[model samples]
Target: MKGPLFYAKILLFGEYGIIKDSKGLAIPYNSYQGALKMSENPSDVAKKSNQNLLKYYKYLSDLKTDLVHFRLDELKRDIDGGMYFDSSIPQGYGVGSSGALVASIYDKYADDKITVLENLTRDKLLNLKHIFSLMESFFHGKSSGLDPLNSYLSLPILINSKDHVEPTGIPSQKQGKGAVFLLDSEITGETEPMVNIFMNKMKNEGFRRMLNEDFAKYTDACIDDFLHGNVKSLFGNVKNLSKVVLSNFKPMIPMAFHQIWQQGIETNAYYLKLCGSGGGGYILGFTEDYEKAKDLLKNYKLELVYRF
Candidate 1:
């Protein structure tokens, strides 16, 4: 038996800035997805997944929140029956791989689970995020819950602050020359270490100033420009955001790509920023001319996301 699939998600204009209550936007990525399944004869991979699920089941059973509840007995039954999560989403790639798993499990096992079909009011959205935050923390050690919220609803989410979230609509993709793409760094990024670094950096008042004044400003502008279809303004803000990230978020970026990241802004071929926690995985790129960016950055693998 298999359950409904949950797609991966991309945070288009939010990363470190969101932690400070900056406006953030996230969209579902249908290219990768996952679901819960049970097999009569489980493979080694499935057996491993089954074991992980049992541990996750125990974690859920210990959750103390009154916001949500799980059908723990049924979940335990399935875990005993070799139920496992089979997924195509790449882990540690910043594309919500674990988030999809969390969402799918919540979909099937949560008692009085929030249904996507219902009229999703603002309060309902925030409640869902709160629940997901608690549930997904088992994986990340700390979670904002935005990732699972986006995957569970399979809709674009706008994060106004830590406590305020809402469903949002982005401008339709256009058949034009500009595009957003993903550049594979080919190295896995650990969320905990990266977050730890950010926390340490937060101790510096100068870093805090840069984050609040420069990073947040540019990120907010980028989100507004993208949602409003202000192509020219979006690229402008993206360039600024890229520069800020390159200078301030150096540790999170893989060392090999530093020159390339600089070259993008210098030549206007593209603007690159962190897709998730940075350090490695996929780096998000925005280009006013996709063909030109492709030619200039021919040494790396690029996956097209959206076209302008």
Candidate 2:
């Protein structure tokens, strides 16, 4: 059986801000996607993925009814029928691999699943977030539910505040040297430990202040600038955001990329930031000149996302 595919998502402008009701934006990145399928035979990865999903399903089943809702029996039946995820998205890469899987299962099995075709009002969106949070908590210890929501909706999600979000439009890309790209670390990174580090660091007043003031400001500006096609302003905010990430999120950066990160800041050729809870995995980069950035960042793999 073939099921719908859900693409991976990227929180381009918001990382930690939207958790505090700050403005944020997310876009669907089609480069990676996952789908549910049933096969008589399965590979090791598929077997492992399905086994993990069973554990997740059990967790969801055990959740208190008052806290969340879903149709668990249908999910069980699908699992019993050899239904498993066949996906190209890499796990531990911060590209919503698990999130897409979770969303696909929920879409297929939940009795009262939110239909993307229905009137997706603000209240509905908020309810989905609450439900998705409970559903996805099986993977990440904590979840905003934004990744799964974006995967489910398959749209660019804009966060105006904690209580408001909707599909958004981005400007058409133009051919140019400038780009937003992903650099592979060729290793997997765990989200829990990185998130733990972030939570621990939040205890520091200085870190909290920077997150609230500088990080939030630049993140918000970048979202606004990108949506409005303010290219000049977007790059300016990206540069500052890159700097803030480099200064405060050292633990998240892969060790080998440290010099390249610094070189970007010093040369203004490119700036890199954690794609998602980086310890390894992929790091996102913004470059005014992709060729130069690629040359300078040679010896590593790069994938272009968008052109400026």
Candidate 3:
């Protein structure tokens, strides 16, 4: 059986800041997507996937009483028929693999949940975020729910405040030399431990100061410049953002890229930051000259995301 499709997401700005109510922007990335389907194949991976879905289903079912409710019968029917996610999105790469699955489940199973076709108002969007947060917490231990929310809606969401968010527009791509890219870590990353490190770091007064001043400053600017299509300013802010991430979020950086991350700051060839929680996964990169950046990072796999 075919189910609703969920897209991958990118948190173009506000990785950690959004937790503190800093300005944030997330866009649906269609390059990777997932959907639920019934499979007759009984491969080990398929069996594991099915088992994972059963766990998530149980989690959702248990939380349905006070949170968003789903049509359990329909979900069970599909599950019994070997329903599993057929997706290209890589797991543990910070690209929303699990988030897409969570979104698809909610879209297909949730009764009276917000529909994508409905005119999404502030209240509905907030409710959706809340429900998706509870639903996704089963995976992440704790969740902001923005990833799954973005996956489900397939729209650009701008976080104005903790309680305020709405659909936003980003500048269309152009054939400029500057670009954003993803660097593969060749290993999977987990989200919870990385998040724990960030939380612990927040306990430091100095970290908090830098977060409020330097980190927030650049994060806010990046969001503004990106939304306004101010490419030049976006690059400048992204540079600072990259620097801050490198210095402060060191543990998140893959050891192999540590030198490259510093080299970019020193030489201004490219800026690198975490794509997600960032123990392994993918590291996001920004560079004014894609060719030069590619050459400098030649040893690693790079995927072009956008051009300035």
Candidate 4:
């Protein structure tokens, strides 16, 4: 028995900004996905996944939350019967691997689950985010729950603040020169360490001020520009956002890519930002021309996400 697939997600804007109640936008990335399955003859990988699920089941059983409840007994029964998560999403790549797992588990085992077909009012979306936050905490020491929520809904979600979230529509994709892409740092990032760094940084008065005055402001503007299909304005705000990230959030970026990140801004060919926590996963890039950006960064691997 196999459950439906859950896709990976990209937090297009508002990475660290959302923690402070700034606006955020997340979209489903269909390039990689995962689902739960019961194998007749399990391989070593499948067995390992089953073992992890066993631990997760225990965690969920002890989890105290009024947002959502799971069918823990049935989940345990399935695990004993050789159930495991068979997935293609890369782990520690900032692309929502654990989130897809969380989403799949909720879909298959949650009692009174919120189906995607339902009317998903604002309150319901908030409830789902709250539930996902609890479930995903087992993986990430702290979680905003946006990744799992995006995977579960399979829709673009606009986060007005921590408590206000709802599904939103992005402008139609165009096969044009301007585009959003991902650069492969080829180094895996651990979410815990990266998040810890951010938390530590948050303790600084200077850092907190910068986050409020600069980071959140630029991120919110970028979200508005993208959703409204304002390409010219979007690129300008992204440029400023890229500069702010490079100057202030240096620790989150991989050491090797610092020069490239700046080069994009200096050259105006592209602008680089944190894809997720950003210690060393994929760096998100925005460019007015994909071909020119590709040529400039020929040494690194690039994957086009959306065209504008």
Candidate 5:
């Protein structure tokens, strides 16, 4: 049996800024997706996936919460029946690979799951986020639940604050020259370490001030400008945000890309920011001209996401 598909997610803005109550935006990326299915002939890869699912099943079975319930017996049976998650979403790339898997499991096994077609009031949204956060925490020691929420809902989400989130409408992709793209870092990122660095930095008064005043300010501005389709203003804020990330989030940026990150700010070719924790994974890029950005960033693999 094959369950429904769940898509990957891209956090266009927010990243670390969201933890400090900065506004954030996330959108569904349909190019990569995942689903739960049973295989007649389990290959080594499929067997590994099944083994992992068995571990996840134990985690979910032991999960204690009234927020959601799962048909653990059925999930267990599926795991024993050579079931595996068949997905194309790359893990450790900050594209919500585990989020999609979490979404798929919830869709297929949850007894009273919140269906995506519902009206989704603010409270309902919060409940879903909380449940996803708990479920995804198995993958990451801690989670905000935004990734799984986006994958499950398959809608753009706007975070007004730490406690406030709502379904949002973003400007449709236009056939324009400006675009949002992803540059593969060719290295996996470890979220917990990067987050620990941020938390440790929070102890410094100067870093706290910059995060509150500079990072949050630009992040909020970028989200507002993006939702309002203010391309000119959005890029301006993205440039500033890029600068702030470079100056402050030095450890998150790979050592090799430090100069490249700075060059974007100076050249106006494109602005790059952390896609997620940013130790290494995908670096999000924004360009007023895709062709120009592509040529300038020719050595790396870039995936165009949205157009301005």
Candidate 6:
């Protein structure tokens, strides 16, 4: 038995800022995806996945929540019958790997799950986020739930604040020189530890002030500028955001890419921001000229996302 596919997601803006009720924007990234499938003869990878699913089933069964209930019996039956998630989404890459898994499980087993076709009011979106948060806590120590929410809906989501979130439309991609891209850090990141560092940093009064004033302000502006298709303004805000991240969020960034992150800001070739929690994963990049940015960073691997 095979279930439907679930895609990965990119949190373009507001990574850590969102934890503090700052606005965030997340979009579906179809390049990497996963789906639930079953096989009579499972491969080694499938066996591992199935084993993981068994643990996840137990976790779900033990969860106490009114937000959503899983059909644990059927889920276990499927796992017992050699069902596993067949996926291309890389774990620990800042892309929504576990989010896709949570989304797939909910898609197949949740009772009275909110269908994507239904009217997704603010309350409904919040409820889904809440439900996903509970389910995904099995992976991340704590979660905002935006990753699974984006994967489940397969649409752009805008978080106005902690309590307000809704489906959003982004400016259509254009074949132009300006672009949004990902730079492979070539190092895997663990979300839990990175998040722990941020949590610890929050105890510093200076860090908290910077987060509330500069980080949130720039993140909110970048979201607005990108959505409005204000390319010039977007770059300006992205530069500031990148600078702030480099200065304050140093621990989250991998040591190898520190110089490049600064080079982009100085040269105006591109602006780099944390793709996810960012101990190492993919670093999000914004450039006015893709070709030139590509030329400037020729040694590093780059993947184009959206074109301006």
Model 6 per-residue lDDT tens digits across residues 145-250: 8899999999999998889998999999998999999999889999999999999999999999999999999999999999999999999999999999999999
TM-score for every candidate vs. truth? 0.98, 0.96, 0.97, 0.98, 0.98, 0.99
Which ranges in model 2 have alpha carbons more than 4 Å from their true place?
Answer: 66-68
Candidate 4, 1-308: lDDT as tens digits: 98999999999999988988999999999999999999998999999999999999999999988888888889999999999999998888888999999999999889999889989888888888989999999999989889999999999999999999989999999989999999999999999988888889999999999999999989999999999999999999999999999999998999999999989999999999999898887899999999999999999999888998
Best by lDDT: 6
- The candidate 2 region of ten consecutive residues with least summed lDDT is 65-74
Q: Model 3: how large is the Cα RMSD against the reference? A: 1.2
Candidates 2 and 4 compared: the better one by TM-score is 4
Q: List clashing residue pairs in candidate 4.
A: none
RMSD of each: 0.8, 1.5, 1.2, 0.9, 0.9, 0.7
Task: State the number of backbone clashes in model 2.
Answer: 0
TM-score of 6: 0.99
Instruction: Report the C-alpha lDDT of model 1 over 66-160, residue by residue, as the tens digit.
Output: 99988999999999988999999888999998899999999998889889899988889889999999999998899999999999999999999
Q: Which ten residues in a row have the lowest lDDT in candidate 3?
A: 60-69
Instruction: Give the Å shift of residue 163 in candidate 2.
Output: 1.9
- How much lDDT does candidate 3 score? 0.87
For model 2, give the RMSD to the true fold: 1.5
Model 5 TM-score is: 0.98
Query: For each candidate, how many residue pairs have backbone atoms clashing (under 3 Å)?
Result: 1, 0, 0, 0, 0, 0
**What does candidate 3's lDDT look like per residue over 54-132, in tens digits?**
8877887678446577888888778888988888899999889888998998888887888889999999998888888
Worst ten in a row by lDDT for model 5: 111-120
In the range 37-120, model 5's lDDT, one tens digit per residue, is 899988898889999999999999899999898999998998999999999988889999999999999888888788878788
Candidate 1 accuracy as lDDT? 0.93
